[model samples]
Target chain A: MSTVERTPSQWRVYRSYHSPFDPCPPRTRYFNVPPNVLQPFQTSARKQFAPHEALRKGTLWPEYFSPYPPEARGGEAE
Target chain B: MKAIWIYEKKLQYPVRVSKCDPRLAKMLIEQYGGADGELSAALRYLNQRYSIPDKVIGLLTDIGTEEFAHLEMIATMVYKLTKDATPEQLRAAGLADHYVNHSHALFYHDAAGNPWTATYIQAKGDPIADLYEDIAAEEKARATYQWIIDNTDDPDIVDSLRFLREREVVHSLRFREAVEILKEYNHTKKVF
Candidate 1:
């Protein structure tokens, strides 16, 4: 005993004439995006690409491979 | 395929090893280069995504990318653990073999100093089979993290390891859901 309601006005029918084997896929109404929590990454990547390209290229991250401070070394025989 | 990538520039869990322990570092290297390690998990899923069904590719892609971040976390722990150890300390701790080859550097090798091999990962192009393998891979990684946690008394290191172990559980759940969705889709299509 189920009732069916019609909502044709809300539906947007899409047509794809290509065969199943076609390399291209039919476009959909929904576009997957980064979640709101991840929106910061999108903004950061945009900024990082601008002034930090050298850092991205590894040439500017000179401290990245620097050795740890001598005082931080703690494996002396007890 | 235009995609937006956001880089949250921080480690998911902080890695603070107060005392540099070369012995512990040697053991942690296994996670970086071990057969069932993060490197293997990342490559397996990333390579498989191209052939994955449209419905599940996103799951594989995101999980695979997260694995790369895990790999970085492990490498960071290893680096900090070996940071300032003397040759004598390293030799006594049984890490000299690795140091002789790489000189306090982080190399892609397991605990036994075996180099990472591409043979560690696989992509069968079948979503169900690959998802099953992914589940097993996550379990293997979680078990390894547990073993690390059990052996170490360092709370700082343990905290990071615990965080990583929890992530494995989450990934397994997501993969399970993806598998169920795939199965339902196939079933519905066959009927219609």
Candidate 2:
């Protein structure tokens, strides 16, 4: 599955409204729903990583990690 | 009898700068000393702990201590990037003012050479207000890391920065949780 399709529920995807009179093309598919919104009180994190992996990711829980690399960001636009 | 931070001999995440790039180092210095920098973050949370609710005091202490580890990581990166760099190289990288003042030594200053100032942080003594500020601070730090990742060519630095940015996300969520915890309390204690 593509990363977009695989994005967890914590990061919700929504459709953007494309207007007819707008000058720029619509970026319809993907925008962020910050993970916190899905969990109001955050009592616990269910899933976790091993010590080595946790150190590498900076979070023991995988759901919270969001990566921003130079390659996939659509250079000069993102 | 009190909370004491046991000395951790290493960074929370490994920090590696592949090659000497004084320019990149100068930019990364912002995280070390800018308004959204780790120093401000560490002090802000730690100072606010005394005034915050007992339920979230441990949360603030844990995140605040971790920020110190991040501060160390940043200092290590800056030192590695500028290691053995010549005065001319430093000047070309727009660190001329820093060089004249610190002479190859790292100083707490932003990418633009603004000295780290106490005005950069606050402790409102209100749990909800303080936690919200903490959340905002995390988002700001995350944005700064993303910008730095965009600007640098070093994969090693990007790797470390990506880790730090994710920690900010987690921290913000924890602060959000802290706010909710505060909200759930009955008003008999006279807390926010």
Candidate 3:
């Protein structure tokens, strides 16, 4: 019943990269809001969220402190 | 502990100046020790902080950083104001003195067009004296910002000026707090 067409090349490329990690879970979700709404709808769950959650959501910690060089990590003692 | 140095690492702030207006840029440069007020504030806070006692070191360090931010804000304003300026407007604003020498590049100079010099700042190394001087300097900056805001018709310029003015107020409060802390330290030592 489906009318959508898929090319052989598209299927091959998709199959080639298909691995356990290919369908990794999303880190965040997007919400769609109605244009007519005057005020943003507040989620009750967000209200009681912990401070760490707020920090993770709001702050750019990763950008502020980048990782050290690989050599700086130090090798095992011989 | 050592102080953390922060670099803006951006263009850092840009200002859009029309060909018709150039005086505003010339005036904003005053804060960077350009014509006198700002550069003086930056140099004053930085130099004076070094001599402050350990008890007030944190406060001094914070104020010094704020001074650096103000310097950036002023420089951004100057850049915006001077951007796309015509030769006639620049000459009329007496920016010719700067453009003639620096070629449209911004430099710290006094209101009278003298280049910024280190003699503008004093660091006596006395906490009490330094605190007093800082309080006075903040007031001077606040007044300067107020004047700039009052004189400028541009909303963008006014907005930046107002922000700078509020910062001056905040810095003044912090300096006062530092003074109180120093006084308390003296009191506790006396009691012991």
Best DockQ goes to which candidate?
2
- Candidate 1 lDDT tens digits, A5-77: 3222212223345578888775423111112112211121232223354332212222111111111212221
Pick by DockQ: 1 or 3, better one:
1
Q: Number of the top candidate by TM-score?
A: 2
Full-model lDDT for every candidate: 0.68, 0.81, 0.57
Off by over 4 Å in 1: A1-78, B1-5, B187-192
Candidate closer to the true structure by TM-score (higher is better), 2 or 3: 2
Whose TM-score is higher: candidate 1's or candidate 2's?
Answer: 2
Q: Which candidate number has the best lDDT?
A: 2
Candidate 2 residues A1-78, lDDT tens each?
A: 223433443333334566799899855344444565466455564788887888788777766666565233322233
DockQ of candidate 2 relative to the true structure: 0.52
Q: Which segments of model 2 are wrong by more than 4 Å?
A: A1-33, A37-40, A43-45, A70-78, B187-192
Q: For residue B82, give model 2's deviation from the true position in Å.
A: 0.7
- Residues B1-192, model 3: lDDT tens digits: 576787876432233333345777766666776423766776677666666777777777766776776677777777766767777778888788788787767777755677787776677778888788887777677666655654567755564565566556556666777777777885665434
**What lDDT does candidate 3 reach at residue B63?**
69
Backbone clashes in candidate 1 total: 3
| Candidate 2: count of backbone clashes, pairs at least 3 residues apart or interchain | 0
Q: Write the per-residue lDDT of candidate 2 for residues B15-130, one digit (tens) a residue.
A: 88886789998989999999999999999999999988788889989999999999999999999988789999998998888989999798888999999999999998878888
